[model samples]
Target chain A: MKTCYNCNRLNKDNDRYCRYCGKAIRNNSYYTGLKIGIVLGTLGIIIMLILYAIMYL
Target chain B: MKCIKCGAELEDVDNFCPECGELTAKGHRFFHDPSNLDILNNGKAVKLKKKFNAIISIFSLSVIIFALLMIFTGQNLMTPFGVIQKKINYYRYGYNTSLIKTNNKYNFKVNNYDEAIEFIKKDFSNQLYTCNQNKELTMLEYELESDYEIPSVVFCDMSLEEAHKIKDVIVRMYALFPNIKGNLTNITITNSKTGSDYVAYFQPAYQFVNVNKDIKENNKVNKTQILLNSYYFLNDNILSQDINEVLNNYYVEDATFESTIAHELGHYISFVAFLREKGVSNITLVTKDNEEEIKSLINEFENGEYLKNILEQALNNYNLKYNENLNLQSFAETISKYAGVKDKNGNLLYSETIAEAIHDYYLHNENAKKSSYEIVMVLKSKLKEVF
Candidate 1:
């Protein structure tokens, strides 16, 4: 079972919304997107440094 | 779930409290967690993080720009580092003010040639003012009646006795060349201790001395004075012996210390004659007209054979090799033979041929070589007519 944060009512675990008040459930996709962005930015900086060294030195 | 406003307990299915009709769902415990509240309200921490990132970005960009500039230009543009290096160089080789203060006790500055002459006269007039007081003193002054005259002086950095000897030689030289008396106002006598050779040269008063001011609006001429090195006169025993031996090979007899002064005076006289013939005051103004005059004069010299023979003989006697293909048809070539040929791009020096000719004419007279004597006679006649 899962608890509805808005209505204070118990619902089925697989339900996407609260049964009593009809509030939509939130997911972890936003946090996952933010982690991917951080990783790609770091890689881009490292690539720029390598290119700079090759061209100049 | 519980509603804090009414302190009422409710079932999970209920939206509001039973006792006070308060909304129990609005006050959820998950949303009221301390950690979540901290993240939502920390504006200062977020602002600080943004400022730190901006600083890092700017610093990295500047470093990259600096590196690129250095790679492209190959010059050290580091301002602070360059300033430090300049300071080090200045400390190492800059002028020594303390030495000047200790040795140069008779230092004086004058505005013009007249003022410099007055200053020198006044200094000499004083009975107490001896050369012993100052071994190295300079009298700085400017030339008179020119549009452009810089502060020039006759420096004497020698012992009292040596300076006096050079002064006497200068007076004698002035007496010989009355025509150059005005230009010979400034005289410098330097000693051997200065690590310089026994060199005597004339520094012209003006780069362009305009003798014919009425003819041209901006006529220029070369007006010069002699500078004598005191070393040859001061240490005559050792230096004169060496010079005399070298001069003896040319069949030149009795070459005294005074002969050197006369030789320099010869250069001055030749320079004056050159200016008069050209009809222009300044050497810098030597144009096709002057070249033509020089060529005609060279032609008039028995078809250049006389000069060619003399030059060839001199070179052979001295063991100095010259250009075999030298064309005496060219005025520059004729002058170069007498003056000693230099590299192609070098300024054609004041003709040493004419100077030596004049020197020989003045000293040897009837005994002087026929070629040199003739050349001097022609130049002197021309100069007398012009002046």
Candidate 2:
């Protein structure tokens, strides 16, 4: 079960929205997106440095 | 959680206000922790971060490509962005270019050697004229050539007027020893304020002159080009007085600027003769290992006892009435020191003895001692035979 802070209503635990009001549920997408971004950025920089050494040095 | 609209305490399972019927669960979450804001603005934040990452990725890629291009092309990556090509010109031509800074101020270059000569002529026209018109008295012929590896003259701490005076001195030197003009290349003029320790010197050109003809005709590789200094011209009056006082000769047709220039030219002439006698073209090739053999041979002709004795006699006369203030002893020593002895500055003293003897032989003529006169005559005849 979950409680809606806006209206003090009790709702089912699996419900994404309160039974009395409508609001999107918070999820872990933000953390997932940030982790993927950091990994990809690091990989890109490493690849650039390797290519730079081979071609220039 | 508590309801915001009706100040009512609520259990976690509540979805609406029990007293007021206000909905609670459907409202936006009260951001108790700052990290919750990221969840709320997840879509926009992700898009912004991705945009920033793309920008950085693109910039890094561009840098890598630029570095690779520079390495492949053998271009200098550190050269300023616009003048990279000019830097290449300096390596290619081995002559003055706009990229080279003279006196750390002026940047000068020409399309070719001829243009370089013309540039100098145009800048110092009045001085060149003074030298040319007075060639008979100065005994110098102006031969400004741009084909050489360096500028004929580099001036430091000198005005255009003084540069003109130095030009006159060089013109006189060339006129006195016309044969040496071919082997001579450049002259650098610097004043006392600039702190020129060498006072005057001659730097041989490293590259072979007339490379194709030299290899075919002489079977030799490089030839030396003589360079002269202009420090002596900085204080002509004081130097002339000192020379007159040291030599006990009146300021007549003897030791003047002409004598100094002639003395330097004598050094060039002796080197040329030495090269010709050895059947060699490059002096740099004659390293210290073979220098003694070559010097011994050259000295047999240039460093005879007769010339040395006369030089010593002159120095002895000067030292008898030495002036503590004047560098007359050093000046005289430059012209007449014994072979192998170093000066106060640890430089070889008698390197110019033969040159000095030659100058005196020319100045004093029949009045010069028998041995000195004969030696100068032999050098003159040998120069004529070889060159």
Candidate 3:
């Protein structure tokens, strides 16, 4: 289990960011969602293309 | 639209100018070096100005002079030729405008780059920092894509390393700076380059360790160890890889990738200060290789006058700050993007944003880390809670 260094708030160890405090649990300087957007968007496009190809072909 | 050299501005003509005898490519400045010619300004005007631009061409073309000089002169004439040109520029403008190439002096003059960083980190801690992503701060809040937490500030002192299944990558160059909680620093970092040690310093002590692009391409082993003084090697394959990439993104200029090595180093500076608060002195944290020496230093600080007070103050301050995390979340969100990212495993990525911010100040300004107190106040309010 992870705990807030400041408040002693118990948190899940696997959780990257905190739930109650919202601070980072392991790495504090992670980018929020810049590339996350690109990665997820790319995956979505690829999936949609595959589905479209299957339906049409 | 017509080629003069071939007279084919497209009319079945060859080797002849449509209107003038000048070769098509020869008449066009685009085909030639656009050195001192204000191409942008000239682009707006359809008609080209002067046939030969004297000033900028001299400035730009002379670079080739010394290179050719060495090849022909068959000696290290490039150095003397550079000196002569610099003197000419000085004589002409009463100032030297020639860029200094490869100055490794700052590393020696500033005393390991951390002192400049400490100046800001310590001051940032002394201020009443506020979390900025509040009600009016809605925009800054959106900037926070994500963040991970370090269990303790101790991770602040690890060596940044990115290890894949096959290889471990070490950054040849990195920066360090202080991250404040607010956006109101007294120190003003800028784009102007001025200073003696290197790139340019906004102030005396602070400087940005601009990415070192000096990679020797030969098999000649030129190695410089990034002493275990960094926090990149804490965990092995146990951290977030996303954080590592984000750190690299920070190196991207003006792309909304905010990062600075100093900001991450700021955390370490604060950690060092925190250690100092515990009455730790001369207790340098070295890598395992230097374990013996550092261990001796730590032993020296076993119990000092300020140790307990340091713990109390920091513990209390941390708790006070965490209580405000939710409200601080918005603030953390704004500055989070600018921060030098790290992975859950303690791998440092790219540059730390605050480090770069201050580095910009250090490189371009005269005051450098001079007014770190104000900078601390501004940064503290914006990032006191992020870590």
> Which candidate, 2 or 3, would have the higher DockQ against the true structure?
2
Off by over 4 Å in 3: A1-57, B1-291, B295-334, B344-387
TM-score of each: 0.36, 0.35, 0.20
- lDDT of candidate 3? 0.30
Descending-lDDT candidate ranking: 2, 1, 3
Query: Could you give candidate 2's per-residue lDDT for residues B1-30 as a string of tens digits?
Result: 777877776666454555454666633354
Each model's lDDT: 0.43, 0.46, 0.30
- Minimum summed lDDT over a 10-residue window in model 1 chain B is located at B95-104
Off by over 4 Å in 2: A1-57, B1-142, B146-151, B155-176, B190-199, B203-254, B284-350, B362-372
Give the chain B TM-score for each candidate: 0.39, 0.39, 0.22
Stretches of candidate 1 above 4 Å error? A1-57, B1-130, B133-180, B191-196, B206-223, B240-242, B246-253, B274-350
Per-residue lDDT of A15 in model 3: 46
Better candidate by TM-score, 1 or 3: 1
Q: What's the true lDDT of residue B259 in model 2?
A: 54
Ranking by DockQ: 2, 1, 3
lDDT of 3 at B39: 29
lDDT, candidate 1, B1-387, per-residue tens:
665666655566644444454545642453355653442234333333444556556556755775675456443334323334334643763411111111122323333335544543343233212122232332211221121121123332343454444444444544443343333333444333352344455543322222334322432222244555654543444444645564433313444455655566665665555445556443322223443443354344423343444344444433333334433223223322433344356543334565555555556776775545555556556557766
